[model samples]
Structures are given as C-alpha cells and as structure tokens.
Target: MVEPGPTTPTSPATPTDPATPTNPTNPTPAPVASPVATNGKLQVVGNQIQNQNGVAVQLKGMSLFWSQWGGAFYNASVVNSLADNWKVTVVRAAMGVEEGGYLTNPAAEKARVKTVVDAAIAKGIYVIIDWHDHNATQHTAQAKAFFTEMAQLYKNTPNVIFEIFNEPDYESWNEVRAYAVEIIGAIRGVGAPNLVVVGTPTWSQGVDAAASNPITQYPNVAYTLHFYAGTHGQWLRDRADAALSKGIALFVTEFGTCDASGNGNLKLDETGRWIDFMNSRKLSWANWSLHDKPETASALVPGASTTGNWPDSALTPSGAFIKQKLLQ
Candidate 1:
C-alpha cells in the first residue's frame, strides 16, 4: 500500500467531487471481441489461469490508481479506452481503504469501485475488485463486509475477480493466509465462485514463503506476485519460479516500469525482461496505474482527458510502453 506522501498523493479531507459513469460523445474505437465473452469463467488449473474450457489464459490490463485520488478515471469512458484502444483483457479497481477512503466515507469510495466494476461488466472484460489496503488484517470486519456485498451482487457474473488484499507490509504469511481464508470464506460463502487473488507478504514479493504454506480450503484461488522492474530483478523471478514449482497459481496484479517509489527513471530493459517472463509463463497481469498523476507509474500526462480517445501526445513514456505491450 502507498503512503500519503510524495510517492502516493494524499487525499482531501473528504471527496467533494466523486466521479459518476458517463458516455462520452467522442469515445475510442469500439472493441471487436470480448475476452469474457470468449473465455467465460476463469479457474486455476495447475498453477495456471484457464478459461471455462480448461485452456490456459493470460489477461493483460491496467490498474486504476487509488479510488480516493484518481477517481476521475473510474468512469466507463476510461474502461472503454482500455478495452478498445489499449486492448486490455482485464481492469483493476484499487479502492483505497484508509485515509479518507472506505473507512471514513464508505458510500463515496464504494461508488467509485461500483462504477468501474459495472463498466467492465458492460464492456465484457474481467474486473478485479482490489482491496487497496496495506493493513488489511486490522480491517478484517470491513473487508469481509465489502467483499461479501460484492460477491452477493455479482454472484453469477463471470467477469468479476476479488483481490482481498493489495499488499501486506510486515505481516507474516501465516497472518496473511489466515486473513485470506476468512475473506475468501466470506466471498465463497455467498456462493460467488469468481477467482480470488491474495497478496503475499513484504509488499507482495513473498511467493516463496506463501508456497511453503498455501491455502487449501479454497478452490479457484491464486497468490499475487507484485514487482517493479527497477527494484525487483531476476532474484524475485527466481523466487516466483520456486513458488510455481510448488504448484500454486500466481498473478501479477500490480507492476511498474520504474522503481518501487512510483517515481523514477524508466527501467525499460528490466520491464522488457519482466514482460517476456510473464508472457513465457502465461502469467496474467495488470499495469500499476492508469491515472495522469506526475509519477513514473501514472500512465497519462497531466490534464489528459478524463474521457476516452487519448492521442499519443497524452501518454507518458511509461504509458506509451505499457500501451505498446497491451496492444501486442
């Protein structure tokens, strides 16, 4: 989880201008094929994410910045651009859980997430309802309530995926795994079989540790493996390989082309290597962010249109690189 500082912008005392869904007049080109329409419900079959037919699948997409600060991009127009222009198969709504987020103003924060989820569903793409909290173990009650409601609402929808925890900072795998069992129980208890992604310890880099002791009660569950190309190198990939050897499914829910600070010089070489690794392994992923904040991770330039139809001038170096990969 990003702290309220230079790397992660702080939110206002309260959200006075939350975003609502709107159909812009000049939208991007329409997407021809729907990933969800083709793949149907995704399942974990032997360390891989597969469609309903048991064929392996890889989903590449963008993750919206924290809902509290980057709420402008939570509308349907952004989702349309990602699906149509960016060629993304999935989108992640990282709803901030602290600061002036869900804990303080549940109604406003949740509305932003619902807008994204509903938009992704309408566009026939997969959506990850991420609980963007670092200290999720302390907020177990709130997390359970939020996911329980989400499961109940989208129980039958195959386009939804629940990320119970974004990144666990200092929590051990045992602590994180226990918290996941309860939240996964909450989601499964509602009869929602949508894929559930759980974060690992040490800012989601402890796949090796999670592999040592994995969750057994859940079906269609996978562990998150987050990385920033600049900070995490082959060492992390080796750890992931070891985890994969243990027969646990892995997903790159959040990644950056720059350092972990969310602002720094672009590491294109490392980013390329990471991309090649994910592609070779068929590991599904979502880019770190889709906002225009002044950071290496933010994809768009400042003052870029909140609506779709972004031209080349509107993209940052990181944005252009990520778009190029998604288009491929």
Candidate 2:
C-alpha cells in the first residue's frame, strides 16, 4: 500500500560501492558508543532477542516513514536527537524499493539509506535496513543485490538488522518463506552475522502462518508483525500469541497509533492494550514514522523543521501521546 501503483518487474541492481564520493548514505563517526555496544550485540535465542551478554533485549523506538517520501528526516542530527532525547534505542530505516523508488532511482534511495545507516553507526544504536516493499516477491533479484551489499558493508557491525521485506500483500506464506530463505542466504554469503527479519503474508499480519513453518537453520532470523491500533485488534493479538506459542520471534517493525490508513483519530484504548501485550512479551517495537505528513499517524505537524529537536507545539496528538509513553 505504500506504493500507489505497482512497479515493473525487474532484477536486483548492483550493490553500491562503499568507497566513493557517491558513497551510500551512512551516519557520522562519533566516538561515543550507544546502547548497541554498551549493552552488546543483539542475537536471537528461542523467541527472544538477546543482547551481547545473552540478556533478553526489548527496544522501544521509531521507524522513519517510507524512505522515498520521508527521506528528508533521515539525517544524523535527527538520529542523535532521537537517541539523546526521545529515549529511542533502535531505529528502522524504511527504504522504499518500488514505485519510483529503488528501481527508478536506485542511487538516490541507496544514498538515503546510507545516510541513515552511517548515522546510526556513528550513534552506536541499532538500526534496521528495511526493504520497504509490499510486492517484494516480484523483486527478489534486486533484494539479493541490495542485501548483499548491506551485509558486506556492515558485516562487522551487529547493529545492522536486515528487513528484506516490509509488508507482503497477497503473497502466500510459502512464497514469502522462499523469498526470505534466498535473501537470507545472500546476506549470510557475505559473511554478515547481523540479524534478518522476514515479513509475513497479509501485510505482515500472518505471524501464525509463519510460525507454523518458518525459515529455520539460519541464525538471528525473526518475523515482522505490523499493526495500526485503530484497525487491528484482538484478532491480530491472537495471531501474534499463536506465533509466540510456537516459539517464533516477532518484531513489530512498523505500527501506527491511528487507523491502518495512516490517518483518522488515534485509538488510545486499543493502543494501550497492544502496548501492554508487547510489554508483557518483551517484544521490540518501533512507531510508524518521523515524517511531518498531514495525518494522525504523522508525529510532526506541517511546516515542522526537518532537523531533530522540535518544539512541543509541533507534535500532533499521536506524537505527544507516544512520546509520553516512550519516555516511560
């Protein structure tokens, strides 16, 4: 749904060369190490994500909205502000891969991603390099190439988690699983030990289906479950519970405090219930975005500055509410 129209089917493009004036986007180099190393590298064990010391880790963070449209906010200063003030420890970079995105302008998209990734590296916080595609099954070749480059570029950085597919629409679990295995193999082939999270069917709400049969035999692999509290309710929770009962690790990479449409009123009641569930399970989660889009889910108001450190008046109702919760 992120893409208004379907992109033409095409193979994966070549990975960007890390060394060049046109180097891919990345964070600046700051001497201070963030939670990423201070706590330790993250790994998967059973249904939980473990820190370097093998302690269970739960990250409360924000996800930058679709990269193509929200690229303006993926800067080092924004990341620094979020980490230093917002109490966020993990950031997901939602790289747009379709519609006039990666396929149409690979260089621009890659640079945008590198900008965020490099900033995250400098900040020393964990980051998710998300292939923000709904029709990822149709772009397997491109995914392989992109992830390969990502793995090799940050093989030494365990903070990099690869989300090969954002939301898989209409694609069956069988199809999604196959694509994930292939992509996971590509990342592993590059000798990158970072974690890889695969999206489930039905816009990543089909966690139970993925749990029934998952992509095992790969280390640090997990599944994605997204929700918009105003729309997704008990039915979604039951599915997530089923996946957990089956020992499947789950990460809520993209979620909104509003309706699934990314607009309308905020559902505080349902949102609280979802938050309680995630808290009880110690599951990591990231809010929908850092964009200033004119919507209830958009945390910032129109005309808000692109740089981090916004005034309280610039926050929307949902932003104010979520920030309070994050501060807790």
Candidate 3:
C-alpha cells in the first residue's frame, strides 16, 4: 500500500490586476515568451542533451507525484527550492485518475500539469509530463485526445517532454508497441516534435524489454525504464548492455529504495549497483519521488502515512545518493 504525503496547499488563483483595462482595445498585452527554445526536436549531443546549442547537458530533476488524485503541490517556495536551490533540472508530473478510473477532465488536468510545468520553466528547468497509470483499460480514445491536445499546446515549446504512458505492466510487448505507435502517431500528427518517452511492458521496470526492441526508428523518442533493487537488478544490467550494444538512448526514469522483488524496501547495495550502472552509461534519470514518506518506502517524504502529512526529513540515504549522482 502506497502511503500519502503532506497535503500540498492549494494555490491562490492569480488575480488579474484590477487596474488593468478589461477591453481588448485597452487591454494589457500577454507576457512575452522566454528566449529559451520552446519548440522543435529536443537537441541531443553525444550522449548528453542540450537545447539548440551543442552543449553537453544532464538532467538533474525531481518527480512530483503529489498532483495525483487532484491534489496540488501548491508551495511555490518548495518548487523554487528544489529547482533553483537544489539545482533540479526537470520535474516529472504524474496525472492521476479522476472519476470512473479514467484520465478524463483534460482541461483541469492540463491546468494542474501546467502549474508545475510553469514553475519549473520559470526556474529554467525542464518538465516532463507523465500520464501516470499502468491499467490498459484506462487507455481509451479520450486519453489519446487529451495527449493530442497536450502535444499541440506544447508543440512549440522544447522545455516540455511528453511521456506517453507511465509503467505499463500486464500487457504484452506487441500490445504496448501498438499502443505506443498509435499514441505517438497521434502526437506527431499534431506537428509537435517534442521528445517522446515510451515505457516498456511489466510496469516499465523491464530493461530487457527495452533492450530487446530498440525504439530508434521513432524521431526524438527515448526508451524509458524504471528500476527498484527489489524487482530489477541483473535484468537492468542486461538491458543496459543491450541499450549500449544497440546504440540506443535509454533513460532510467524512476527508481528507489525497493529491491528487485518489490518485497522489503531500501536495499542500499542494490541501489548502489544501479547507480553505478547509470553513472557508467552517463544515462539520465529521475528518482521515484521527492515527497517525504518512509525509509524503505518509495515516497521520499518521511513518516508519510497511508493518509497524512509527509515528514520534513524524508530524503533517505537512497534519495541522497540520487541527489548526489544527478544533481550535478
């Protein structure tokens, strides 16, 4: 059972300046776009990612799962602290299930996503918008529509990367590949060339699956795999070898204290091995979570109950390891 973290506060709506004109002819102009590259294929150089330039860049980021279930990480100070102070480069957001187990309510969900995305962007960090679910039953036409809309909206913005789906276990590779193809095709149809990250079968924890079928054919596509010492170790190594041999880019997007079996949590040895592998490969990664929860648990927030406030010092040894490795 996953534990809950501190209830993130609600953000007050940004009230428009009342003194500003209300009519179009006498209206205030929209904010100017930041000079950063906001569109086109994500630039990659050698093994490192970059913007338009050829600079070697690494993504040091955090994952925000608090937005799940309609909640918000309303603390801008926390966001700024992580991005500006902690030097996080990206923020992975998980869009949770709404009513009837569907990822519906696109407008509301997108707005929620934008809150975090905009926060990261304001801090000059990249943002990854993840459709966090593994249930194939949830991947309906409406979900595709939502993604397509997102693609169009961020088509011109390079700072945003759209993760087509989260961990997708219980489905065969053929099924996942087909779903990916369809979803990717739809997103591309909208003329958006942002980097698209796709997950493998078996909860996206299967590195072997990703290594077996390299997704190099898709433009700006990066294969993503999650890891937890309890569930994946040697398999991850094998997959990493496969990725290296195939010359395909891989991202170890999510991992944490758990072992390969997902039994007990916080296996330091296994975590070290995985970290070593990623470091050797110079791969990009995002830790499983940042919120305070438990030591052996996946959430970073400490003392996080199944339903309660998260602890302040939840950054475990593993989280610290991740921070050291990625927060370069």
Clash totals, every prediction: 0, 10, 26
Q: Write the per-residue lDDT of candidate 3 for residues 246-290, one digit (tens) a residue.
A: 655666666665754323656778877877777676666677666
Per-model TM-score on C-alpha atoms: 0.92, 0.91, 0.76
Name the candidate that leads on lDDT.
1
- Sequence-dependent TM-score of model 3: 0.76
Of candidates 2 and 1, the better by TM-score: 1
The pairs that clash in candidate 1 are: none
- Residue 192 in model 1: lDDT: 86
Cα error, candidate 1, residue 16 (Å): 12
TM-score of 2: 0.91
Best by TM-score: 1
* Error of model 2, residue 92, in angstroms: 1.1
